[model samples]
Target: MTLRIALRPAPLLLRFILPRPSLLLHQLPTRRAGHGPGQRVIHYMGHQAGATQPPTPHKTIHFCSQCAGPVDLKFVSSEDRWRHICSACSHVHYLNPRNVVGCIVEHEDQVLLCRRGIQPQLGKWTVPAGYMELQESTAEGAARETLEEAGAAVEIVAPYVHFDIPGIGQAYLLFRARLAPPFTFAAQAPESLETRLFPLEDIPWDELAFSAVSLALRYYVEDRRSQSWRMHHGVIRKQAGAGPNDPGSFKLTDYMGLPLGAERIQTQA
Candidate 1:
Protein backbone atom coordinates (compact mmCIF):
# COMPACT_ATOMS: atom_id res chain seq x y z
CA MET A 1 0.00 0.00 0.00
CA THR A 2 3.00 2.33 0.09
CA LEU A 3 2.89 3.02 -3.63
CA ARG A 4 0.84 6.00 -4.80
CA ILE A 5 0.59 6.86 -8.48
CA ALA A 6 -1.72 7.61 -11.41
CA LEU A 7 -1.94 6.67 -15.09
CA ARG A 8 -2.65 8.47 -18.36
CA PRO A 9 -4.58 7.01 -21.27
CA ALA A 10 -2.70 4.35 -23.23
CA PRO A 11 -3.79 1.90 -25.89
CA LEU A 12 -5.33 -1.17 -24.28
CA LEU A 13 -3.60 -3.50 -26.74
CA LEU A 14 -0.21 -2.92 -25.14
CA ARG A 15 -1.24 -5.11 -22.21
CA PHE A 16 -0.81 -8.36 -24.14
CA ILE A 17 2.92 -7.85 -24.72
CA LEU A 18 3.78 -7.35 -21.03
CA PRO A 19 5.43 -10.19 -19.15
CA ARG A 20 2.83 -12.40 -17.45
CA PRO A 21 4.65 -12.69 -14.11
CA SER A 22 4.77 -8.89 -13.78
CA LEU A 23 1.00 -8.51 -13.49
CA LEU A 24 -0.06 -8.95 -9.86
CA LEU A 25 -3.60 -10.17 -9.40
CA HIS A 26 -5.67 -10.54 -6.26
CA GLN A 27 -7.62 -13.77 -6.24
CA LEU A 28 -11.12 -14.24 -4.86
CA PRO A 29 -11.58 -17.67 -3.33
CA THR A 30 -14.42 -19.54 -4.96
CA ARG A 31 -17.41 -19.09 -2.66
CA ARG A 32 -20.93 -20.38 -2.36
CA ALA A 33 -22.02 -17.53 -0.14
CA GLY A 34 -25.61 -16.46 0.10
CA HIS A 35 -26.87 -14.61 -3.04
CA GLY A 36 -30.52 -14.41 -1.97
CA PRO A 37 -33.19 -16.93 -2.97
CA GLY A 38 -33.20 -18.93 -6.21
CA GLN A 39 -29.74 -17.88 -7.33
CA ARG A 40 -26.98 -20.43 -7.79
CA VAL A 41 -23.41 -19.23 -7.54
CA ILE A 42 -21.27 -19.62 -10.66
CA HIS A 43 -17.71 -20.92 -10.39
CA TYR A 44 -15.82 -18.60 -12.81
CA MET A 45 -15.71 -14.84 -13.09
CA GLY A 46 -17.04 -13.00 -16.21
CA HIS A 47 -20.06 -15.28 -16.49
CA GLN A 48 -22.19 -12.56 -14.99
CA ALA A 49 -22.98 -8.99 -16.18
CA GLY A 50 -23.29 -10.11 -19.81
CA ALA A 51 -19.49 -10.11 -20.04
CA THR A 52 -19.00 -13.19 -22.21
CA GLN A 53 -15.73 -14.41 -23.76
CA PRO A 54 -14.57 -14.68 -27.36
CA PRO A 55 -14.80 -17.52 -29.97
CA THR A 56 -17.75 -18.70 -27.96
CA PRO A 57 -19.73 -15.53 -27.34
CA HIS A 58 -22.63 -15.43 -24.89
CA LYS A 59 -24.90 -14.32 -27.68
CA THR A 60 -25.10 -16.44 -30.79
CA ILE A 61 -23.37 -14.86 -33.76
CA HIS A 62 -25.37 -15.27 -36.92
CA PHE A 63 -24.26 -12.15 -38.81
CA CYS A 64 -21.12 -10.03 -38.86
CA SER A 65 -20.95 -6.54 -37.36
CA GLN A 66 -18.98 -5.22 -40.33
CA CYS A 67 -21.28 -6.61 -42.97
CA ALA A 68 -24.79 -8.01 -42.67
CA GLY A 69 -23.59 -11.17 -44.40
CA PRO A 70 -23.72 -14.57 -42.75
CA VAL A 71 -20.64 -15.32 -40.62
CA ASP A 72 -18.78 -18.53 -39.81
CA LEU A 73 -16.07 -19.27 -37.33
CA LYS A 74 -12.93 -20.45 -39.11
CA PHE A 75 -9.15 -20.02 -39.25
CA VAL A 76 -8.28 -16.94 -41.27
CA SER A 77 -5.11 -15.82 -43.14
CA SER A 78 -2.82 -18.54 -41.65
CA GLU A 79 -3.74 -17.35 -38.15
CA ASP A 80 -4.02 -20.09 -35.55
CA ARG A 81 -7.04 -18.50 -33.86
CA TRP A 82 -10.46 -18.95 -35.37
CA ARG A 83 -12.36 -15.79 -36.22
CA HIS A 84 -15.81 -14.77 -37.32
CA ILE A 85 -15.42 -14.40 -41.08
CA CYS A 86 -18.14 -13.21 -43.39
CA SER A 87 -19.21 -15.91 -45.82
CA ALA A 88 -20.25 -13.57 -48.61
CA CYS A 89 -17.97 -10.54 -48.19
CA SER A 90 -14.99 -12.50 -46.63
CA HIS A 91 -14.54 -9.70 -44.07
CA VAL A 92 -12.97 -11.09 -40.92
CA HIS A 93 -14.55 -9.85 -37.70
CA TYR A 94 -11.98 -9.55 -34.95
CA LEU A 95 -13.43 -9.83 -31.50
CA ASN A 96 -11.52 -7.86 -28.94
CA PRO A 97 -11.91 -7.11 -25.24
CA ARG A 98 -14.47 -4.46 -24.35
CA ASN A 99 -13.58 -1.51 -22.18
CA VAL A 100 -15.76 -0.69 -19.17
CA VAL A 101 -15.19 2.70 -17.59
CA GLY A 102 -16.50 3.88 -14.25
CA CYS A 103 -15.68 5.89 -11.17
CA ILE A 104 -15.41 5.41 -7.43
CA VAL A 105 -17.12 8.65 -6.44
CA GLU A 106 -15.89 9.55 -3.01
CA HIS A 107 -17.47 12.28 -0.87
CA GLU A 108 -15.75 12.47 2.48
CA ASP A 109 -15.93 8.97 4.03
CA GLN A 110 -18.82 7.75 1.93
CA VAL A 111 -18.74 6.14 -1.52
CA LEU A 112 -21.60 6.11 -4.03
CA LEU A 113 -23.04 2.77 -5.20
CA CYS A 114 -25.99 1.88 -7.34
CA ARG A 115 -28.50 -0.98 -7.35
CA ARG A 116 -28.68 -2.44 -10.83
CA GLY A 117 -32.11 -2.73 -12.45
CA ILE A 118 -30.85 -4.87 -15.31
CA GLN A 119 -29.53 -8.33 -15.79
CA PRO A 120 -27.51 -10.49 -15.30
CA GLN A 121 -27.21 -9.27 -11.74
CA LEU A 122 -30.43 -7.38 -11.31
CA GLY A 123 -30.90 -5.89 -7.85
CA LYS A 124 -27.17 -6.19 -7.04
CA TRP A 125 -25.20 -3.13 -5.92
CA THR A 126 -22.16 -1.66 -7.72
CA VAL A 127 -20.27 1.55 -8.36
CA PRO A 128 -21.49 3.48 -11.41
CA ALA A 129 -19.80 1.85 -14.44
CA GLY A 130 -20.56 0.59 -17.92
CA TYR A 131 -19.17 0.02 -21.42
CA MET A 132 -17.08 2.77 -22.97
CA GLU A 133 -18.33 4.60 -26.04
CA LEU A 134 -16.41 5.27 -29.22
CA GLN A 135 -14.20 8.42 -29.35
CA GLU A 136 -14.58 9.04 -25.60
CA SER A 137 -11.61 8.97 -23.25
CA THR A 138 -11.73 6.58 -20.31
CA ALA A 139 -11.96 9.44 -17.79
CA GLU A 140 -14.74 11.10 -19.74
CA GLY A 141 -16.57 7.80 -20.04
CA ALA A 142 -16.29 7.20 -16.33
CA ALA A 143 -17.70 10.63 -15.57
CA ARG A 144 -20.50 10.11 -18.05
CA GLU A 145 -21.45 6.75 -16.54
CA THR A 146 -21.49 8.27 -13.07
CA LEU A 147 -24.00 10.90 -14.18
CA GLU A 148 -26.09 8.53 -16.26
CA GLU A 149 -26.36 5.68 -13.78
CA ALA A 150 -26.35 7.55 -10.49
CA GLY A 151 -27.47 10.96 -11.70
CA ALA A 152 -24.54 12.43 -9.81
CA ALA A 153 -21.76 14.59 -11.17
CA VAL A 154 -18.18 13.71 -10.35
CA GLU A 155 -14.80 15.33 -10.86
CA ILE A 156 -12.30 12.84 -12.21
CA VAL A 157 -9.43 12.45 -9.83
CA ALA A 158 -6.99 9.80 -11.00
CA PRO A 159 -6.79 6.28 -12.33
CA TYR A 160 -7.41 3.77 -9.59
CA VAL A 161 -7.56 0.30 -11.07
CA HIS A 162 -7.28 -1.46 -14.41
CA PHE A 163 -8.82 -4.94 -14.14
CA ASP A 164 -8.63 -7.42 -17.00
CA ILE A 165 -11.11 -10.27 -17.06
CA PRO A 166 -9.91 -12.34 -19.99
CA GLY A 167 -12.65 -14.87 -19.37
CA ILE A 168 -15.17 -12.16 -20.19
CA GLY A 169 -13.16 -10.41 -22.85
CA GLN A 170 -13.43 -7.06 -21.04
CA ALA A 171 -11.17 -4.61 -19.26
CA TYR A 172 -12.38 -2.33 -16.48
CA LEU A 173 -10.94 1.14 -15.90
CA LEU A 174 -11.90 2.60 -12.55
CA PHE A 175 -10.93 6.10 -11.45
CA ARG A 176 -10.99 7.72 -8.07
CA ALA A 177 -13.36 10.64 -8.51
CA ARG A 178 -14.79 13.34 -6.26
CA LEU A 179 -18.45 14.11 -5.91
CA ALA A 180 -19.49 17.76 -5.88
CA PRO A 181 -21.09 19.49 -2.93
CA PRO A 182 -24.57 18.35 -1.86
CA PHE A 183 -23.67 14.76 -2.89
CA THR A 184 -27.11 14.02 -4.19
CA PHE A 185 -28.00 11.33 -6.72
CA ALA A 186 -31.01 9.78 -8.41
CA ALA A 187 -31.42 6.48 -10.23
CA GLN A 188 -31.87 8.19 -13.57
CA ALA A 189 -30.44 5.49 -15.79
CA PRO A 190 -32.75 2.67 -16.81
CA GLU A 191 -30.13 0.19 -15.69
CA SER A 192 -30.11 1.47 -12.12
CA LEU A 193 -32.92 0.96 -9.64
CA GLU A 194 -31.50 3.11 -6.81
CA THR A 195 -28.39 4.91 -5.69
CA ARG A 196 -26.97 5.40 -2.21
CA LEU A 197 -23.81 6.23 -0.37
CA PHE A 198 -22.37 3.90 2.23
CA PRO A 199 -19.56 3.96 4.70
CA LEU A 200 -16.69 1.58 4.10
CA GLU A 201 -17.93 -0.91 6.68
CA ASP A 202 -21.52 -0.76 5.50
CA ILE A 203 -20.82 -1.60 1.86
CA PRO A 204 -22.68 -4.74 0.70
CA TRP A 205 -19.74 -6.91 -0.20
CA ASP A 206 -21.71 -10.07 -0.89
CA GLU A 207 -24.31 -8.31 -3.00
CA LEU A 208 -21.93 -6.56 -5.38
CA ALA A 209 -22.77 -6.82 -9.06
CA PHE A 210 -19.33 -8.14 -10.06
CA SER A 211 -16.17 -9.46 -8.45
CA ALA A 212 -14.21 -6.48 -9.76
CA VAL A 213 -16.59 -4.13 -7.91
CA SER A 214 -15.98 -5.95 -4.67
CA LEU A 215 -12.24 -6.06 -5.36
CA ALA A 216 -12.15 -2.31 -6.06
CA LEU A 217 -14.07 -1.51 -2.87
CA ARG A 218 -11.81 -3.74 -0.82
CA TYR A 219 -8.72 -2.04 -2.31
CA TYR A 220 -10.14 1.41 -1.66
CA VAL A 221 -10.90 0.57 1.96
CA GLU A 222 -7.49 -0.97 2.47
CA ASP A 223 -5.77 2.06 0.94
CA ARG A 224 -7.69 4.40 3.21
CA ARG A 225 -6.75 2.37 6.26
CA SER A 226 -3.07 2.42 5.32
CA GLN A 227 -3.22 6.04 4.07
CA SER A 228 -1.53 5.03 0.83
CA TRP A 229 -2.88 4.53 -2.67
CA ARG A 230 -1.43 3.38 -5.95
CA MET A 231 -2.82 2.54 -9.34
CA HIS A 232 -3.70 -1.19 -9.59
CA HIS A 233 -3.46 -3.28 -12.72
CA GLY A 234 -4.40 -6.95 -12.65
CA VAL A 235 -6.28 -9.75 -14.31
CA ILE A 236 -8.97 -12.24 -13.29
CA ARG A 237 -8.91 -15.62 -14.94
CA LYS A 238 -10.76 -18.90 -14.44
CA GLN A 239 -9.41 -21.20 -11.80
CA ALA A 240 -6.93 -23.64 -13.30
CA GLY A 241 -5.59 -27.05 -12.10
CA ALA A 242 -7.11 -28.95 -9.22
CA GLY A 243 -5.32 -27.79 -6.07
CA PRO A 244 -7.08 -25.08 -4.05
CA ASN A 245 -3.97 -22.95 -3.53
CA ASP A 246 -1.84 -24.03 -6.46
CA PRO A 247 0.11 -21.30 -8.28
CA GLY A 248 -1.66 -22.36 -11.46
CA SER A 249 -5.00 -21.98 -9.76
CA PHE A 250 -4.75 -18.21 -9.46
CA LYS A 251 -1.70 -16.47 -10.82
CA LEU A 252 -0.93 -12.99 -9.44
CA THR A 253 1.51 -11.12 -11.64
CA ASP A 254 2.92 -7.60 -11.66
CA TYR A 255 1.55 -5.01 -14.08
CA MET A 256 3.12 -3.86 -17.31
CA GLY A 257 5.67 -1.02 -17.25
CA LEU A 258 3.69 1.53 -19.20
CA PRO A 259 4.46 4.98 -17.77
CA LEU A 260 1.49 6.91 -16.41
CA GLY A 261 1.04 9.44 -19.21
CA ALA A 262 2.63 8.14 -22.39
CA GLU A 263 1.13 9.26 -25.68
CA ARG A 264 1.63 5.89 -27.35
CA ILE A 265 3.19 2.72 -26.01
CA GLN A 266 4.63 0.15 -28.36
CA THR A 267 2.33 -2.85 -28.82
CA GLN A 268 5.01 -5.12 -30.26
CA ALA A 269 7.66 -6.52 -27.97
Candidate 2:
Protein backbone atom coordinates (compact mmCIF):
# COMPACT_ATOMS: atom_id res chain seq x y z
CA MET A 1 0.00 0.00 0.00
CA THR A 2 2.92 2.30 0.67
CA LEU A 3 4.34 1.67 -2.85
CA ARG A 4 1.64 3.77 -4.59
CA ILE A 5 2.90 7.15 -5.89
CA ALA A 6 0.35 9.87 -6.75
CA LEU A 7 0.64 11.70 -10.10
CA ARG A 8 -1.36 14.91 -10.54
CA PRO A 9 -3.14 15.76 -13.82
CA ALA A 10 -1.90 18.77 -15.68
CA PRO A 11 -3.34 21.84 -14.03
CA LEU A 12 -6.33 23.49 -15.79
CA LEU A 13 -4.30 26.69 -15.98
CA LEU A 14 -1.59 24.89 -18.03
CA ARG A 15 -4.21 23.39 -20.39
CA PHE A 16 -5.77 26.79 -20.92
CA ILE A 17 -2.39 28.24 -21.93
CA LEU A 18 -1.80 25.69 -24.72
CA PRO A 19 -2.37 26.71 -28.33
CA ARG A 20 -5.26 24.97 -30.13
CA PRO A 21 -5.68 24.07 -33.81
CA SER A 22 -8.88 26.08 -33.95
CA LEU A 23 -6.98 29.31 -33.32
CA LEU A 24 -4.71 28.63 -36.31
CA LEU A 25 -7.67 27.99 -38.57
CA HIS A 26 -9.29 31.24 -37.48
CA GLN A 27 -6.29 33.14 -38.86
CA LEU A 28 -7.51 32.39 -42.39
CA PRO A 29 -10.63 34.52 -42.68
CA THR A 30 -13.18 33.63 -45.37
CA ARG A 31 -15.24 36.15 -47.28
CA ARG A 32 -18.85 36.23 -46.18
CA ALA A 33 -20.02 35.38 -49.71
CA GLY A 34 -17.93 32.59 -51.15
CA HIS A 35 -18.85 31.72 -54.74
CA GLY A 36 -18.70 28.06 -53.74
CA PRO A 37 -16.39 25.56 -52.06
CA GLY A 38 -13.78 26.20 -54.78
CA GLN A 39 -15.04 29.31 -56.56
CA ARG A 40 -14.60 32.91 -55.53
CA VAL A 41 -17.77 34.94 -55.27
CA ILE A 42 -17.32 37.66 -57.87
CA HIS A 43 -20.12 40.06 -58.63
CA TYR A 44 -20.49 40.99 -62.25
CA MET A 45 -22.34 44.01 -60.93
CA GLY A 46 -21.04 46.09 -63.87
CA HIS A 47 -17.75 44.55 -64.95
CA GLN A 48 -16.93 42.51 -68.06
CA ALA A 49 -13.92 40.84 -69.54
CA GLY A 50 -11.61 43.28 -71.40
CA ALA A 51 -13.25 46.03 -69.36
CA THR A 52 -12.50 47.76 -66.06
CA GLN A 53 -14.36 46.87 -62.87
CA PRO A 54 -16.57 49.12 -60.66
CA PRO A 55 -18.23 51.98 -62.45
CA THR A 56 -17.02 55.55 -61.97
CA PRO A 57 -19.93 56.40 -59.69
CA HIS A 58 -22.28 57.19 -62.60
CA LYS A 59 -20.90 55.37 -65.63
CA THR A 60 -23.29 53.02 -67.43
CA ILE A 61 -20.97 50.73 -69.39
CA HIS A 62 -17.99 48.85 -67.99
CA PHE A 63 -15.20 47.01 -69.81
CA CYS A 64 -14.50 43.27 -69.58
CA SER A 65 -11.26 41.93 -68.16
CA GLN A 66 -11.04 38.94 -70.48
CA CYS A 67 -11.80 40.50 -73.87
CA ALA A 68 -11.97 44.26 -73.34
CA GLY A 69 -15.55 44.16 -74.54
CA PRO A 70 -17.98 46.77 -73.30
CA VAL A 71 -20.23 45.65 -70.47
CA ASP A 72 -23.64 47.27 -70.63
CA LEU A 73 -24.89 48.60 -67.34
CA LYS A 74 -28.64 48.78 -67.18
CA PHE A 75 -30.27 50.58 -64.31
CA VAL A 76 -33.37 49.20 -62.72
CA SER A 77 -36.44 51.41 -62.34
CA SER A 78 -34.50 53.08 -59.57
CA GLU A 79 -31.35 53.20 -61.77
CA ASP A 80 -29.76 50.22 -60.05
CA ARG A 81 -27.59 48.12 -62.38
CA TRP A 82 -28.81 44.68 -63.46
CA ARG A 83 -26.82 41.67 -64.64
CA HIS A 84 -27.45 39.64 -67.78
CA ILE A 85 -25.25 36.64 -68.33
CA CYS A 86 -25.16 33.89 -70.94
CA SER A 87 -26.34 30.76 -69.10
CA ALA A 88 -24.04 28.51 -71.12
CA CYS A 89 -20.74 30.45 -70.95
CA SER A 90 -21.13 32.13 -67.54
CA HIS A 91 -19.46 35.34 -68.60
CA VAL A 92 -20.39 38.83 -67.51
CA HIS A 93 -21.36 39.96 -71.01
CA TYR A 94 -21.20 43.60 -71.86
CA LEU A 95 -23.66 45.31 -74.17
CA ASN A 96 -21.04 44.79 -76.89
CA PRO A 97 -21.42 42.53 -79.89
CA ARG A 98 -21.27 38.77 -79.46
CA ASN A 99 -18.81 36.23 -80.88
CA VAL A 100 -20.22 33.20 -82.70
CA VAL A 101 -18.83 29.67 -82.50
CA GLY A 102 -19.77 26.81 -84.81
CA CYS A 103 -19.03 23.23 -85.79
CA ILE A 104 -19.03 21.45 -89.13
CA VAL A 105 -20.50 18.24 -87.80
CA GLU A 106 -20.13 15.01 -89.74
CA HIS A 107 -21.35 11.42 -89.56
CA GLU A 108 -20.64 8.86 -92.25
CA ASP A 109 -20.38 10.82 -95.53
CA GLN A 110 -23.18 13.26 -94.72
CA VAL A 111 -23.17 16.55 -92.80
CA LEU A 112 -25.29 17.76 -89.88
CA LEU A 113 -27.37 20.84 -90.68
CA CYS A 114 -30.11 23.05 -89.29
CA ARG A 115 -32.77 25.14 -90.98
CA ARG A 116 -33.35 28.61 -89.63
CA GLY A 117 -36.82 29.18 -88.32
CA ILE A 118 -35.98 32.83 -87.69
CA GLN A 119 -34.84 35.74 -89.86
CA PRO A 120 -31.36 36.87 -91.11
CA GLN A 121 -30.98 33.55 -92.95
CA LEU A 122 -34.40 32.11 -92.28
CA GLY A 123 -35.33 28.88 -94.05
CA LYS A 124 -31.64 28.48 -94.90
CA TRP A 125 -29.33 25.52 -94.23
CA THR A 126 -26.23 26.10 -92.13
CA VAL A 127 -23.77 24.35 -89.82
CA PRO A 128 -24.66 24.17 -86.12
CA ALA A 129 -23.63 27.35 -84.30
CA GLY A 130 -24.42 30.33 -82.10
CA TYR A 131 -22.85 33.09 -79.93
CA MET A 132 -19.80 32.33 -77.84
CA GLU A 133 -20.09 33.11 -74.12
CA LEU A 134 -17.69 34.16 -71.36
CA GLN A 135 -15.20 31.81 -69.77
CA GLU A 136 -15.33 29.13 -72.43
CA SER A 137 -12.62 27.58 -74.60
CA THR A 138 -13.17 28.18 -78.29
CA ALA A 139 -13.57 24.47 -79.00
CA GLU A 140 -15.83 23.96 -76.00
CA GLY A 141 -17.93 26.88 -77.15
CA ALA A 142 -18.19 25.32 -80.59
CA ALA A 143 -19.23 21.94 -79.22
CA ARG A 144 -21.65 23.39 -76.67
CA GLU A 145 -23.28 25.48 -79.36
CA THR A 146 -23.50 22.52 -81.72
CA LEU A 147 -25.43 20.62 -79.05
CA GLU A 148 -27.66 23.54 -78.13
CA GLU A 149 -28.42 24.45 -81.72
CA ALA A 150 -28.79 20.88 -82.99
CA GLY A 151 -29.39 18.86 -79.81
CA ALA A 152 -26.57 16.46 -80.56
CA ALA A 153 -23.30 15.49 -78.87
CA VAL A 154 -20.07 15.10 -80.84
CA GLU A 155 -16.36 14.40 -80.54
CA ILE A 156 -14.22 17.29 -81.77
CA VAL A 157 -11.27 16.81 -84.07
CA ALA A 158 -7.99 18.53 -83.22
CA PRO A 159 -6.99 22.04 -84.44
CA TYR A 160 -9.94 24.40 -84.59
CA VAL A 161 -10.69 26.40 -87.74
CA HIS A 162 -10.62 30.18 -87.31
CA PHE A 163 -12.38 32.88 -89.34
CA ASP A 164 -13.03 36.56 -89.01
CA ILE A 165 -15.96 38.22 -90.76
CA PRO A 166 -14.88 41.67 -91.78
CA GLY A 167 -17.26 44.67 -91.84
CA ILE A 168 -19.61 42.65 -89.64
CA GLY A 169 -17.29 42.80 -86.60
CA GLN A 170 -17.77 39.06 -86.25
CA ALA A 171 -15.19 36.38 -85.49
CA TYR A 172 -15.78 32.67 -85.84
CA LEU A 173 -14.16 29.55 -84.46
CA LEU A 174 -15.24 26.36 -86.17
CA PHE A 175 -14.50 22.80 -85.16
CA ARG A 176 -14.73 19.54 -87.06
CA ALA A 177 -16.88 17.01 -85.24
CA ARG A 178 -18.00 13.42 -85.48
CA LEU A 179 -21.68 13.31 -84.57
CA ALA A 180 -22.58 10.90 -81.82
CA PRO A 181 -24.46 8.13 -83.65
CA PRO A 182 -28.24 8.38 -83.44
CA PHE A 183 -27.88 11.99 -82.45
CA THR A 184 -30.78 14.21 -81.44
CA PHE A 185 -31.50 17.50 -79.71
CA ALA A 186 -32.42 18.14 -76.09
CA ALA A 187 -35.79 19.53 -75.05
CA GLN A 188 -36.18 23.19 -74.01
CA ALA A 189 -33.07 24.18 -75.96
CA PRO A 190 -34.43 27.17 -77.84
CA GLU A 191 -31.45 28.45 -79.82
CA SER A 192 -32.50 26.66 -82.99
CA LEU A 193 -35.95 26.43 -84.58
CA GLU A 194 -35.32 23.25 -86.59
CA THR A 195 -32.58 20.67 -87.21
CA ARG A 196 -31.86 18.35 -90.14
CA LEU A 197 -29.14 16.38 -92.00
CA PHE A 198 -28.03 16.65 -95.62
CA PRO A 199 -25.54 15.42 -98.16
CA LEU A 200 -22.79 17.87 -99.28
CA GLU A 201 -24.49 18.33 -102.66
CA ASP A 202 -27.71 19.25 -100.92
CA ILE A 203 -26.11 22.04 -98.82
CA PRO A 204 -28.11 25.19 -99.43
CA TRP A 205 -25.36 27.35 -100.89
CA ASP A 206 -27.90 30.03 -101.69
CA GLU A 207 -29.04 29.98 -98.05
CA LEU A 208 -25.98 29.37 -95.85
CA ALA A 209 -24.87 32.11 -93.46
CA PHE A 210 -21.37 32.90 -94.82
CA SER A 211 -18.86 31.71 -97.41
CA ALA A 212 -16.59 30.34 -94.66
CA VAL A 213 -18.99 27.42 -94.28
CA SER A 214 -18.56 26.47 -97.90
CA LEU A 215 -14.83 26.86 -97.42
CA ALA A 216 -14.95 24.40 -94.56
CA LEU A 217 -17.01 21.95 -96.57
CA ARG A 218 -14.58 22.15 -99.43
CA TYR A 219 -11.66 21.69 -97.03
CA TYR A 220 -13.25 18.57 -95.54
CA VAL A 221 -13.61 17.07 -98.99
CA GLU A 222 -9.89 17.62 -99.43
CA ASP A 223 -8.99 16.77 -95.83
CA ARG A 224 -10.10 13.16 -96.25
CA ARG A 225 -6.82 12.69 -98.11
CA SER A 226 -4.48 15.42 -96.72
CA GLN A 227 -4.55 18.22 -94.14
CA SER A 228 -2.68 20.90 -96.08
CA TRP A 229 -5.00 23.65 -97.33
CA ARG A 230 -5.40 27.35 -98.11
CA MET A 231 -8.77 29.04 -97.61
CA HIS A 232 -9.58 32.72 -98.08
CA HIS A 233 -12.65 34.82 -97.35
CA GLY A 234 -14.99 31.87 -96.84
CA VAL A 235 -13.97 30.36 -100.15
CA ILE A 236 -12.23 27.03 -100.78
CA ARG A 237 -9.15 27.27 -103.02
CA LYS A 238 -9.14 24.20 -105.18
CA GLN A 239 -7.32 23.48 -108.43
CA ALA A 240 -9.70 22.88 -111.38
CA GLY A 241 -11.48 19.59 -110.84
CA ALA A 242 -8.99 18.56 -108.14
CA GLY A 243 -11.45 16.66 -105.94
CA PRO A 244 -13.63 13.55 -106.34
CA ASN A 245 -16.15 15.79 -108.10
CA ASP A 246 -15.49 18.75 -110.41
CA PRO A 247 -18.94 20.32 -110.51
CA GLY A 248 -18.20 22.02 -107.17
CA SER A 249 -14.48 22.62 -107.79
CA PHE A 250 -12.66 25.99 -107.80
CA LYS A 251 -13.73 28.87 -110.01
CA LEU A 252 -10.31 30.56 -110.41
CA THR A 253 -6.70 29.66 -111.23
CA ASP A 254 -3.17 31.18 -110.94
CA TYR A 255 -0.62 32.17 -113.62
CA MET A 256 0.59 28.56 -113.86
CA GLY A 257 -2.94 27.54 -114.78
CA LEU A 258 -3.34 26.01 -111.31
CA PRO A 259 -6.80 26.43 -109.89
CA LEU A 260 -6.59 29.49 -107.63
CA GLY A 261 -8.87 30.91 -104.94
CA ALA A 262 -11.97 28.94 -103.82
CA GLU A 263 -12.55 27.84 -107.40
CA ARG A 264 -10.12 24.90 -107.69
CA ILE A 265 -9.97 22.02 -105.11
CA GLN A 266 -7.78 18.95 -105.46
CA THR A 267 -9.06 15.39 -105.84
CA GLN A 268 -10.04 14.27 -102.31
CA ALA A 269 -9.62 18.00 -101.65
Output the TM-score of candidate 1.
0.69
TM-score against native, each model: 0.69, 0.47
lDDT of each: 0.68, 0.50
Clashing residue pairs found in predicted model 1: 8-260, 22-253, 22-254, 23-253, 23-254, 24-253, 24-254
- Model 2 Cα displacement at 114 (Å)? 0.7
The superposed Cα distance between candidate 1 and the true structure at residue 20, in angstroms, equals 11
The residue ranges of model 1 lying beyond 4 angstroms of the native Cα positions read 1-60, 64-67, 239-269
Residue 253's lDDT within candidate 1 is 35
For 1-269, candidate 1 gives per-residue lDDT tens digits of 01223444554532233232232235321122122343332233423443333354343467977769898877443444568778988887778999999999888789999999988688899999999999777878888899899998777766788888776678989988888645678997678999998999999876887766777787788766766665666675546332222233444333322224422211110
Give me the overall lDDT of model 2.
Answer: 0.50
